[model samples]
Target: MRLSATSLEQVPPGIARYSYHRAAQDIGIVHFGLGAFHRAHQAWYTDLCMDSGERGWAISGVSLRSPTVAEQLNPQDGLYTLTERSGGESTTRVIGAVREVLVATEERETIIARLGSPGVSVVSFTVTEKGYARRTGGSLDLAAAEASFYPLLTDGLRLRRERDLPGLTLLSCDNLPANGRELERLFGEWLTERAPDLAAWVAAECAFPSTMVDRIVPATTPSDIDALENLLGVRDEGAIFTERFSQWVIEDRFAGPRPRWERHGAQLVRDVAPYETAKLRMLNGAHSALAYCGLELGHEFVHQAIGDPMLRGLIERLMRQEAATSLAPAAGQDLEAYADALLARFADPALNHRLIQIAMDGSQKVPQRWLETLAYHQRYGEPCPALIEAIVAWLRHVRGDRRPVDDPMAAQLAALWATEGSSGIAAALFGPQGLFSHVWRADEASLARLTRRLG
Candidate 1:
């Protein structure tokens, strides 16, 4: 048996599952980057809302790059299982909020048409940071912009404007700091050059609310699929396994209607920067450090690395003493408690959060996760020993000294590393055009500490 609408009755017993039987439900949300995280987090939340008898918000997921996700879920009638594991306990739920999956390569016109629909009150995206085509200086890369998601999104918005439909909320669910404002600037710049009238309309009408989404979603392997099948007595190609923990914090500003995500545990706040900053620097920063350092240390999974007392100790100091110093005290937040909880989450053995998986797109991830905090320390004349170690490991990883690199800037970085050799790699890494351009390279004391620690 396969897990589809027809086979819902056979989805094992005792699992908390539901079916989307609302015939009048329309697509009220369009999402870009239909990856595992979006499926596990946003779509799951919308599913919960529907389970509570909330109508609308059925998602039409779009893939900007390939058709792999569409290939996986469309056959099963947009149905897939989410297995949330915590410690030794696990629960499976079949998600039905995803009404359809469309690929840009196959249905660009349909995507544009749907975006212009009055029914779609939200245009949300989980397109990774690299998809934004943002430079280190927070400026859009004009050449790369044309080939990125921004252009596609602008086209959709243009269609909406021409159709005279109500402007939708442009929600950015990526990990970049001030992600909503970044999208606002990105779309604003593109529109100003192409269509000035649309730019003014977007500025006056559309809302780009910043969001903080936290979940540990690992890449699904064949073993995971087999295990899920054994549990449900059905094969589900679209199944995803994730940690039981999840969070969604949104800046409470929307142009039009949105799913009452607050009804289902999402935080809607006036300012998301404080929460965003704390989570990015502490949680995301530690994850990047673990990825680079753990990969260098030959640890495959996050649990394997975090389980080690020594590595865990290093991470603790990084979070509490180093990264936390740069963040403003968020109201009602226990920074130390959050740090401890992060370690527990990282040490969750059930979800195999691979180091290499987190390590991919290092060029895109480092600036926000590691360099931002390091820059703060340098500005204050303080030392950041743990962050330095992570940077050294990243330099090694990008240079292919330890493992295969999977970054978009891999070719450029490899060429620089090869030209510079061991003696010059450090300088090249912190150079003007490198990923760590904002990091201090002239501070002799910090450089010495980095050298001593790296040695």
Candidate 2:
């Protein structure tokens, strides 16, 4: 018989399993954007809590954009497998931390109602960088503001206001640096424009806890599902595949009740800025560098790029140069060791995090992860040749001659590329008040170097 969520009683041998009925009874957290990464990381932590018989950490997965995820997960009765691959061995665990899957598209009111519920202590988001509708300077993208504001205002925030809901913690799990502050700014901006009174109420009542989350969970494929069935003797159509390493560092700014996530290996700190800077500059910056530069060198996936001796060397050098200088001591980090571990993680052949996946939203990502470090080096009178080269690669990739792939930033970057001249592409990237105003003032020689590299 096919294993259904209802059929689950005890935890399965290879996979952590639970019955649908049992999951339904547990509640405390509501997570937005129920993607693979969230499942592999946050939900995994919650699963640890559930196994320990802890209360107030069970999650309700919510999807804002697509009905497809809800459809796929609900049929499995919200039961999914999390496969962790390291060196040569793989471990499969069925995560039943998610009690329910709700499609906000079909039932927007229902989602808002759930968010407004007194029982829901935390509202966490993993909606990616673009989901915030933010621009480069860590400000709300007023031009693209409606994409997020409309849904949040009408469906989520409005309901919260109407119901006079109590304060709750808002945790953002996107890759953006200072994610908490960014959300605060966005929410503040949206509210000031639409509902000033409620905005003040939110400012006083809610907590936007900044967090640093890291893991590589690629989109699930049929082969992954097949592997789950063959290895664990169970059919899990909604299985998620990821690397073995995971980390979550949270700033303890919660106004309401929160999971003792620390119990499940999550670190609760007084401030997460140092950790955020370390991860963003060292890990995310290097990833962006590899994504553009390695893709330009004719690679399809991150593991493939790491396998190449020359590109691998380039990645290591860039990380050592850029990240080492950018990370602050307060981040409580070891730059060298972190870089070494990053290289090994990227080289994990079993995890297929594609180049295209990392290459997405370069316009939104580069400012925080790469450009900020470059600007820091510039201010200190240091050479950022490798970092500059990565920017050039990004500019070339955006020009559509090198990668030939479609990215969300393609059109905007193409427009920027058209303005490139003997003056330089660096000028174009930095001169734009929209993206890099806070960091760079557009140096002539740097622009010249960028132009020369592109030529």
User: Please, what are the lDDT tens digits per residue for candidate 2 over residues 87-112?
Assistant: 78887777778777887657767777
How well does each candidate superpose onto the true structure, as a TM-score? 0.96, 0.92
Quantify all predictions' global Cα lDDT against the true fold: 0.85, 0.76
Model 1 per-residue lDDT tens digits across residues 1-455? 66778887887677677655745678999999989999999999999988888788899999987899998998888889999998898889988898889998789888888888888989999989888887756777887777666666777888888888778899999998999998998878877776677788788879999999999999999999998888888889999899988899999999998888899889999989878988888999999999888877889999999987778888998999998889887689889889989999999898989999999998888888888788888888888888888887887788876667898889988998789775566666664454466654436665555555545
Q: Which residue ranges in model 1 land beyond 4 Å of their true spot?
A: 431-435, 439-442, 451-455
Clashing pairs in 1: none
Error of 2 at 121 (Å): 1.0
